[model samples]
Target: MKSSNFLKYTALLVFAIAIGFFAYMVNASKALSYLSHDPKACINCHVMNTQYATWQHSSHARDVGCIDCHLPRDNMVNKYIAKARDGYNHSVAFTFNTYKNAIKISDDGAKRVQENCISCHASLTSQMVKNADANHNYDDPSVATGRRCWECHKGVPHGKVRGLTTTPNNLGVKEVQ
Candidate 1:
């Protein structure tokens, strides 16, 4: 009976410790904030400070949040799925310092951003769309087959120059509640 009691207490203690560690990590990383629409959440890691700062000074800053240009708008399920996937990848990269000094979007993320660019400015791009090649889908097996919006408008929101050291004085961003 004493051994059984000890086992039960030990299990409970282990569970408690696991829960406590999880809670601490979540809070420390601002994990919950990623679920919100606030742009400040993007700055949770120092690696993203440059991106967050460059975006702040862009015209798109006045109109859209990070997820607006980055994630899919098809449905909540896909949105959160992409968010969770990207969040996991980002956390892993940031934790291990595996990300590049000049951060670039994943292929899937680039596709999403391209789709969003076309979607948001469809009216303006209608002529180009009509003139595009018959096989010019954004998902063409070869990326060289078609043009991406950023190819010509590289400096739209993120600016022409980008790197970890590019925006040294970018700490002016105020946190959102």
Candidate 2:
């Protein structure tokens, strides 16, 4: 009976310690910051500094934030699910220092950005959509696939930051040729 009790206590202690450690790590990492819509949360990782800096000078800076363009406008559950998934993926990548030097958005992220662009600029893009359908062959692959807004408006937020390398201080390491 005493041995069983001892084993039970040991298991409980281990669980408590595990929870405590997770809490400590989350606190240290400022994980709660990511829950907010603040753009600053994105720059928590130094690698995003360039994106953040470019965004500051972009036209959208006055109107929208990082989350506005990057996340979905779905229900709260869907939104938070995407946020949690992204936060976990980002944490793992940043923790392992496995991110590419020139950051690239995942396919899922690209889809979300495209949806956001359409939703936000519906007034402007609605006409473009009508024109494209009216003028072009809808069966053509180029027309059928539809053009992503960023395909033409690439400099909106990040402003051609892709393929450009710079230090955290905004010093360009390699000029884009």
Candidate 3:
């Protein structure tokens, strides 16, 4: 075989391997499910089982979902963009086992959640804003005093005690079809 043909075949083999690995990862990760609004998608990774179980038992389970509180609701494009970015970050963190035992939300994620909380409870939040001051500038960090709803309601969906080992019985999270 000529030197050119040997190199060509080697490159083709490498490309094939790369494609195969990518496909395998996608299937193994159930990556396509992340595109859906199904809350069960979060439990695809066992690490999220506790969250899933807790949320399942929460008041919001019947009316809201993980995506509603976690992702941007302003538009479909922003929602998916945030989802993809978060998915990549989570994948990297989980793949390398670099995540903390007690996972905490990122700054951006906290902001998104806060905005969602207010959006969902706009009537109540509007009243709070009015009572806070006459300006009705609750969105402004300086004016609103930088308070998160979760700060007061620590056990909204996920309970107060949260960690990798905190809820060992989280296996109660059922597999959704």
Candidate 4:
């Protein structure tokens, strides 16, 4: 075959491969959209598996969707950066099979989470805390567990379980065909 014809063929093949890859990604994205909010879906990537499991059993899991807390409240730049950074971290942990996904986020993430929790629950108390009840010793580190939000309010409020029981269907229901 002529050298120019060979080069043309190679170029065409590469272009076809690129198009195929893009189409595959588009289809994959569609399927992923429905599952993205699921906590188990987050664990599919290995690195997040531990966190996902802990969260599933945790009070927060009942109410808080994965993106609800992980997503930043700030601008698109901040939100996407957090998402990308989280994705990169997940990929690294997944690749290494590191079970210790106990993320000690630079104190900043801790503060942000605390702040978000406090801000949302301002009406609940003078300040946010984990063990508002007298029996649950506030100081005993081992006895107490999970996000401070669960201390006064049961996991019901976060888990949507509470809403399911009390809320009327007409309140927020969107009728479908």
Q: What is the C-alpha lDDT profile of model 1 across 36-120, one tens digit per residue?
A: 9998899788787777777777789888999999999889999999999999999999989899977889999999999899889
Q: Itemize residue pairs with steric clashes in candidate 2.
A: none
lDDT of 4 by residue, 1-177 (tens): 699999999999999999999989658544364336665556455344434444555566556877666566667688668767776665666567764634444455555565566555555533223535433333556654544444454353232223322322234433211
List lDDT for all candidates, in order. 0.80, 0.79, 0.81, 0.54
Where's the lowest-lDDT run of ten residues in candidate 1? 168-177
The TM-score-based order of candidates, best leading, equals 1, 3, 2, 4
Tens-digit lDDT string for candidate 2 (1-177): 999999999999999999999999889888889989888789788878888877876898887999998888977887888888998999899989999977889999999998898788887667665676633323357656565667767788777555445334445543221
> Which candidate's lDDT is highest?
3
- lDDT order of candidates, top first: 3, 1, 2, 4
Worst 10 residues of 4 by lDDT: 159-168
Best by TM-score: 1
Clashes of each: 0, 0, 0, 4
Q: 1-177 in candidate 3: lDDT tens per residue?
A: 699999999999999999999999899989999989898899777677777767776788888999999999999999999999999999998889897866789999999998999899999888877677533457566765556788877688777545444433453424332
The C-alpha RMSD in Å for every predicted model, in order, reads 4.1, 5.3, 3.8, 9.4
Off-target runs (Cα >4 Å) in candidate 4 are 18-35, 96-103, 125-177
* TM-score, one value per model: 0.82, 0.75, 0.78, 0.54
Error of 1 at 142 (Å): 15
TM-score: model 3 vs. ground truth: 0.78
Give the higher-lDDT candidate: 1 or 3: 3
